[model samples]
Target chain A: MSLTLVLVQTLNGLQLGVLLFLIAAGLTLVFGVMDFINLAHGVQYMVGAYFAAWFTAMTGSFFVGLALALPSALLLGLLLEILVFRHLYGRDHLAQVLATFGVILFLNEAVRILWGAAPLSVPVPEILSGSIVLMPGLLYPVYRIAIIVAGLLIAVLLYFLVSHTRAGMLVRAGATHPRMVSALGVDIRRLFTLVFGFGAMLAGFAGIMIAPILSVEPGMGDQILILAFVVIVIGGIGSIRGAFVAALLIGLVDTLGRSFSGDLLRLVMSPAEASQTGRAIAPMLIYVLMAAVLFFRPAGLFPAAR
Target chain B: MSDLVSSASTSDVPATPRLRGTVALLVPAAIFLAFALAPLLVHAGLDPFYLSIVVRIMIFAIAAVSLDLILGFGGLVSFGHAAFLGIGAYAVGILASHGAGDAFLQLPVALFASAVFAFLTGWISLRTKGVHFIMITLAFAQMAYFMMTSLSAYGGDDGMTLWTRSTVAGSKVLGDTTAFYYACLGALILSYAICRCLVVSRFGRVLRGAKENAVRMEAIGFDPFRFRLVAYVVSGMICGLAGFLLANHTEYVSPAYMAWQRSGELLIMVILGGLGTLHGAIIGATAFLFLEEWLAGFTEHWRIVFGPLLVLVAIFMERGILGAVTRRRR
Candidate 1:
């Protein structure tokens, strides 16, 4: 690939990575703080996208629509926590898995019933919708750059909240020792609710932000959820910093592997054979990375407070 | 309470193993009779569609039971169990497409592929426990799903359809619906039997002990990790056999067969039936399938109700269906 193409792909990878971080940040935090395996976290992301898309279509303004959608998504998260997730705490992991998976089934079908089965889209606002020239000969979508910027901004905000705030201290405390935090009389249950809700909102935000470009459809969150899981596993569960770093690494590896694996293989093999083998092997690259990471560091690259 | 005392005394008086043995046979005997008789009572003379559905349920029951072995008894909670299923199905599908349509050859290839995949993935996954282990297994399975989807040579995401079922030593035994149903039933029964034996065996004791207290097991000089790994491999192989039956039943294999959702469904089956019990898987699979079928019939949005139902079950049922029953009987 040419230098311009390489640079563009690299940027694209970074953009994807940041989006993953947005999803994984909430997931890792929830896993860390609540010790709950919320499979429906992906459904929250899907809900955000669908809600944003529908609201934007109605309001005819992306920003206003997103502003409204965020609160609704958070409300939904809290409602779900109160109605269902509250009961799952202290249960075995298997129970949590089954219960959350049921949530996934319900939400995915609910979205399908509400929005119809076809894919929906949200429009990129005119101001940042156009392409921007990054180099002499290359142009990148302004929307993608916006995503990268927004994702990083959230990451910085998260770092601050998690490292500087009292709530963050409680969150970190809960991650390492829930019983001790409760013994300290910090209302651990409420802390867990807040963490779960916030994580849900973050996931929803990621979904809404990316809605303009991606297909907003039923089960949209499933694949990304798997990728986020990989990021956390590679980065170390319960570690936001690990999730961020690992998300970027996986994003780059997955995106670049898809784009260049075939061409890279062609250098040493016949074009047809390279294409076939590359296609077969490309999907496995991240998993191989995960396995390698686990092999070297069983806890993950940067395991959180735990 | 008096009856319990009398039964306990009687059981304590030298014939306890025999009594326990008879009780163990009771449920499966009842289930066997029902399944055998249900086909006879069908309105449309054993509607092929229902037969197919039941067969599918049986096939999945095998896989679910295997997963329960690792998750419930061994405390492994693998999320990539579907990968073994996919491996087995793909092996059958690929081999059949290449003219090796004989069940004898296809079975070995499927088993071997599944065992290898399980061995490699389990070797790494068993290192982690709880959620990390779950996610790692899930990631590995997703990798398998994506790889299968990318295989444009084999119909890719749409999946590959076998023109015909595998042959049995130059005979077309699998082509017969009744025969195939019985064959799958046989497979399911055999798997259940093997699991039953395994759970009470020496190996099963160690596996169960690890689940109860890994630290204690380690303290007692058992390397719980290795035992868990072996269980994982065996569980994976068992799921692979289920995959083989599934592919044979449907005559089609798709990436969807190994989706993480399917893995979740398998977990639901195990829990719904009862954790740490062999027959629970069979009941769970049947009940789950029938519930879905009935619910979907009532409303297209059945999962809305089903989802809440699952949450309620988790909230209220600490020991699951079978556990609740066994406790009451005790």
Candidate 2:
């Protein structure tokens, strides 16, 4: 209800939005280019968290761990592409969903096997730890602000890569009309591999970034993966700009709804009833938002040309 | 059963039955008869544990058979069918908690709750095709799950335990394992028969035609939406009945009943037995449950092995167990 609290929540929402954008970007691209739904995309995010945790523990340096984690995540993505996803490209969406689901089961268990089921935490870097006052009586975590900044930079970079690069054009084409791209003599398979790999790395990067704050545990990606899917669906399946905008919107809505639903409901109902009803509705707000969005724009906002 | 139902629903199939068609039908009938005898096995000094397991399998089999109604027969791959089961289970839990322990009362409420949910969600979800439909159904199910988690009074995340199973005409027969097993078997057979009848009906043909080619079906004067919505509701009702039995069978109900993972499991069962073949849902559910039971006996990390097995099935075993059985008959 207070301005400072709202401001903090907004910033938190933005940070969460950034993470979702990173994950959604990869998923949308893989979906757009190859018409494949990689349910295991979330597992790649989980893998990045585990790999970063392992490397940080081994090297005793957070930055070094990140430095090593990126390429390894990319390799992991491409390797999965070759091993499981490649064969699924021409198959139906059901097949893709099932296979990727298998990948999730395998990876989640593999992580549990390698690292016990107990939640693991990576400490925030000393330099990024603590809070800064954004206004009178309003202090926010410096690490979260850094996450927002980093996420925005990636957004700008992604915008540039998609709009200005030849590879980006191909990706766009793949989403809109893969057959046309095929007719134009480009190796569509290799292009899909590139896009899929890049998407995997982006998800990995998000996982590594968030490991400090959220519990890095098995199956953590499952919920976020669904959220990312919601983001892409609201933004329009193949549209990066849609993903960015929708991710932020979803982030803000979900966070603010959770924090303010009780207060908002109290205006019309008794305190106890309001609070209980608000609590129930908070978790469902995003899904409600998605349903409303789809009602108006069945294909999502900023639908691809295809 | 969806595989067979789909054939029954679609008109393009040649009138001539395949040489193995009788064998395929017989295989599932044999399986059902064998399942019905599970309680007998227990009474004859075989482990009663197996009866409980088979009852659980039948309960899931009911849910899976309903799913095949839409997924296999109608070509609507709903990823949230478990929500219906959850709704049905919750219906029993809520009513029983309030003192309505009668099967007649619980079954109607469960079916009504699930049917209404299916009506609302299906109305919205059926508007989209393919991947969007899957995601939308999944989203709705998750919404239901979150709602369940927020229900602080009804045991919330911990779930609720029934003091007694549902009564049939004021009789306590359901409290016995053999009685419960027969109840479940009866429900499964009735559902299978209803689904088969629906598939062969004219309305079902329209749903099938739409699945095959909506535009063509539309040209033929069918409004695909109405047929699909009806199919979705019918499917939800049957699954809801399963939920009723499940609540009694386990004497427990939780939000976990509607988890997306359970939905995934249901889909895998339908696929494993061969999609579109109604009876395959039973086979798939049985195989999947048995595999889980057998594998867990070997190691705590059975999921690691099970995961790869799912992957192998997805990648290579396209026709599933029923398909393999009928193929061999040739």
Candidate 3:
């Protein structure tokens, strides 16, 4: 393996990891705080991408598009929360699962109705479009590096806000004991609204950021949503820190596994057979990793609440 | 029905039968009988297409019933039950593609592979509770799904087509639509009966007890993990059987059959029919598939309507169709 290829792949893995963290942070929080399972969270990602795509196309400016799209995404999320999710809180997990599943079905089809089934793509902004040389004979895309930096910065900022701020403390407390938080005379409902809305926007932001590189289509978020679930499960639901670490871990594992598993297998066996087996097993390696994690620490590596 | 099963233990009253109990058992039996006799009565009138729909319903009903074995009765919500189904289907498809279409050999192979996967996944998944457990099972299922997608020798992403259905005593019986429908109906009824007996049995009592109060069950000397694990395996095996039937039913197996959406649909079948009720699985499958069929016939955007309807069901109707019916009787 050449050093340049390894560095490039590692950078790609980090970029992917950061994006996953952004989405998973919101997901784990919604899950931990409300004890609600939202399958439609992926659709919010889809919506964000679509919103960005549409706004960018209309105004011909990525920054302007994002400035307009983020709040709209947050509003849409809050609207859904008020109309549907609020009713589902305190219900059994089955109801939450079913209702959110319904939202997924609706939103996926709705997107298709609105944008057709063809995959859509957002153009990389002109300023961040090109690549920069990293090491001797190696170069990486500036946009992807930007994504990594932005994602990490968000993660650091989130840590500060969650661990050092009152809202973060309330969020932590609410995750463990919702009733106690309500009894403290804080408008628990407002807190939940902020949490849910903010989480949705974060997911949407990840979607928009990724739209340039990944295919933007209906049902695009479905697979990643499950992976995000894996990330949260391995990271501990409702813990942003856990989400960040686990998201990066899963992203690295999945990305690296997909890239090198065939080569790794070819070292031991004939090319054809190794490639076949590697192709078959590589995608599942992360899931195997998750299973191993859950087996040892059922609550995940860093559970935020009891 | 898990609700019926658990309510008996939770209520203060001992050994008192509610009216809803009788209806729960009877309503499902009637639905089963209707489907059982469907081919005989509609054989002359219905087209092959409609007959096949009923057969599809029977196949999914078997899967849903097996899912209820764990989700409804045991309260171990498994999002990856479709993995077992896919494993079973793929087993039959791969075997048949390799010229091993005999039921005796294919069925055991399907059951064994699915059982092993279930046991391994369940062993890890059952260690967690609530959302962790749900997500873990889902991840495991996704892993299986990815594996299936990578099996290029077996048609991989596009899916493998079975050249022929399972041969039973050197006959073409399964090739006939009516015969296959009856075969599936028979399997559904048999699985339902077995589930009925198993849930009321001593093993079942312990499983349901764990669902009600894991701490209490543990206190009383039962290891909820082992009991739930066994239930998970049994449920997986049952779903595998349904998968075997599914591959045989369509003579085609694809990764799409085991998609997470399929798992979600299976859960929908359980909840919509009335969770924890054995017959509810059948009812849910029938209603869900039939609704899809009817709605698709009416409009292309049926999902738009169906999604909101489901949210409404979750928000307003907590008990589901069967639960509502039974609750009113009480």
Fraction of true A-B contacts recovered by candidate 3: 0.90
| Candidate 2 per-residue lDDT over residues B151-257, each given as its tens digit | 89888889999999998889999998777888889999999888877876787677777888899999988899999999999999999999888888889999999
TM-score for all predictions? 0.95, 0.96, 0.95
User: Model 2 compared with the native: what TM-score?
Assistant: 0.96
The digit string of per-residue lDDT tens for model 3 on A1-306 reads 677887888888899899999999999989999988988898999999999988988999998999989998999999999999999888989998889999998999998998888998889999999999888799889999989999999999999989899999999999888899999998988999999999999999998899888888999889889888889988988888899999999888888888888899889999999889989988899888888888788888898757
Tens-digit lDDT string for candidate 3 (B1-330)? 455633532333321123257634666678887987777756577666887899989889999999988887788888888898898899899888888788888889988998899888888788888776777888889888998899898899999988899988667788887778888888888888888777878888888888888999999999999989888888898899999999998889999888999999999999888777667788889889998999999889899989998999898877677756655555
Model 1 residue B33 lDDT score: 65
| Residue B48 lDDT in candidate 1 | 61
TM-score of chain B of each: 0.90, 0.93, 0.92
Model 3 lDDT at residue B321: 78
Better of 2 and 3 by lDDT: 2
Report the alpha-carbon TM-score of model 1 versus the true structure: 0.95
Checking candidate 2 for backbone clashes, the offending pairs are B1-B276, B1-B277, B1-B278, B1-B279, B2-B276, B2-B277, B2-B278, B3-B276, B3-B277
Instruction: Compute DockQ for each candidate against the true complex.
Output: 0.66, 0.69, 0.83
User: Candidate 2 or 3, higher DockQ?
Assistant: 3
Per-residue alpha-carbon lDDT of candidate 1 for residues B107-138, written as tens digits (9 for 90 to 100): 88888888788888888888777776877798
CA shift of A291, model 3, Å: 0.7
Candidate 1: give the clashing pairs.
none
Q: Candidate 3 regions off by >4 Å? A: B1-24, B40-44
